[model samples]
Target: MSADFAGETARLYARFRRDLPSDQAAELAAQLGLTADDLLLDLGCGTGQLTAPLLPHCAGAVAVDPEPGMLTGLRDRGLPGVVAVLGADTDLPQLGRVLPPLGALVVGNALHWTDEASALAAGAALLRPGGGLAVVTQGPPLWLGGAPWQQAVRAVLEQFLGPVTATCGSDAAALADRVGLLEAQGLTVRVSSWRADHPVDAAWVLGHLGSALPGDALTSGGLRQALEDELDRQTGPLVEQVLTTAVVARRT
Candidate 1:
């Protein structure tokens, strides 16, 4: 299934989607043996959240996404040493022709949207000798976890978005499965986790929900009002614990 974001949805995503912390990005870079001479490829780079921060550590980067609006957001940032490419995981081979052999290919929270095996193979093909591929998957959204206000938020989400999956990407089994797939593609895989806390207010919560749900769902279904009312009942700021797991695989 092709996942493409456009229009206001892309705008919300660019505004609300969080980037990986700098410390975590540096740690992953070190693990991948990325250096200033290396070229990084950020596959499915939504608004350059995970791609922009890592630019300083690499020679240059190619940020690829199928959505033009997301690319426009990235381009608007005017980040140097980065080129935005309009393509998906399947187009990496063609992308390689225009760009140098990559030192690392990074996929953040986007592996589920593509053919995982084919994407990995294409990534491996694009990498230079001794280059690597890294896949970073974040844990569940804060609203889905066991916080008092978060519980209320989730109830509103379920009422409109249907039953939420407990474990979408960040789980032990899923990590292991990704490792196995990478290994099968002739890569030596390693996994690591990072934990951080993010403080968010009511506005952040609502914006996050808006990014996930369609505008019609939020505006027409009375879901937006219900969420606002529930959030208003909360007393303090919400602390969201972010757990990011990285599966790094090196082509031998």
Candidate 2:
């Protein structure tokens, strides 16, 4: 857990990050054969983005994240049947001692942060027989390689952050690696996608970047104004089609 997603940064993340789709949750529930007795374990929950929507589909949810600040305010967000825990992928075995039998285990946009193979193995151990495991990629950031408007955003970001690429283990090669891991455990891999479109303005870009960069000088030292100036000139549809990919499989 980095300070980038802690304290004030966590608040920005909670406010700016989009909620995970209910349709996707439903899909996982069906694939996992979720019953009223099964609980969903949401690793890297990050303010319950996956947990809240998933809770209704399962008996209850165990939302875990390593960042303590990131775990704050999840309970007050009108979520019932949600238990937030400050833990990480590496702690799954110990965490499992206190958790119920899981019908599904979801790692949403957080696989790149740890030893992915180990995390996947630990997650598998916690599942009940015939349960499902899903790894979701939250897609690239808004300023990731794209149209000219985004190129301009990228340029400004590069000036401050020094050569950034949106490689978050969502690419084809990373997916293949994940699929192989699941197959090693005798779980057949199935990949699915859910998409949400976000139109970027200066404010939206600022919030999104702020969430990721928090406390960085990128939004300071006059770079914020420069980014705004650069964006003001680019004219085209700047909608970011966030294609959320789910690499899923069931225990066979």
Candidate 3:
């Protein structure tokens, strides 16, 4: 299945969606054996959150995503050694022919939206003999089971949206499934994880929720009011724990 973001949703994603922490990016680079000479491929590089940080570690980068708005945001950054492309994982074969063989391929928090096996195969085909593939995922959303305020936020979402499944594959079951799939592809898999706390205010929370949910769901229904009421009751800035997990594999 393909997902596209535009208009207000794209705006909210560009503004509020957090980037992979610099330190975490470094650790992931080390795991992938990334170097200054290797070309990096950031698949589904939404607004360049995961693309920007990984640029310095590699020789250059080609960031690709299907959404035009996301590509626009990446292009706006004008990052050196980075080129944003409008395409999906399935387009990588053609990309490989024009561009040099990639040293690394990264699917950051966007693998769940595509057919995993097909995407992974396409990515592996683009990588050089010993190149690596890193799937960077921020474990289950902060609002799902983290803090009191976030738990309250989850309740509000469920109340309006019914049972909610996170768009990003953040849960333990999903992680296990991903690892199994990668292993099945004849690639060696290794995982690294760490937790981070991000300061969040009402606006950040609202923008984050808006990016994930449809506009009408929040505005037309009573969901928006309920969400606002919950946020208003909170005492101070919510310190949310962002758990990041990186699954690294080699094309060997």
> Using Cα atoms with residue i matched to residue i, what is each candidate's TM-score against the true structure?
0.94, 0.93, 0.94
TM-score of 2: 0.93
Task: Name the regions of candidate 1 deviating beyond 4 angstroms.
Answer: 1-4, 166-168
Give Cα-based local distance difference scores for all models: 0.84, 0.81, 0.84
| lDDT by residue (tens digit), candidate 1, 88-176 | 99898888787788899999888888888899888988888888899997766666667788888888878877886656566678788
For all candidates, what are the clash counts? 0, 0, 0
Which should have the higher lDDT, number 2 or number 3? 3
Query: Per-residue lDDT of 65-109 in model 2, one digit per residue for the tens?
Result: 988887885765868788888889988999889876689999888
User: Which residue pairs clash in candidate 2?
Assistant: none
Q: Pairing residues by index, what is the TM-score of model 3?
A: 0.94
Task: Give residue 10's error in model 3 in angstroms.
Answer: 1.1
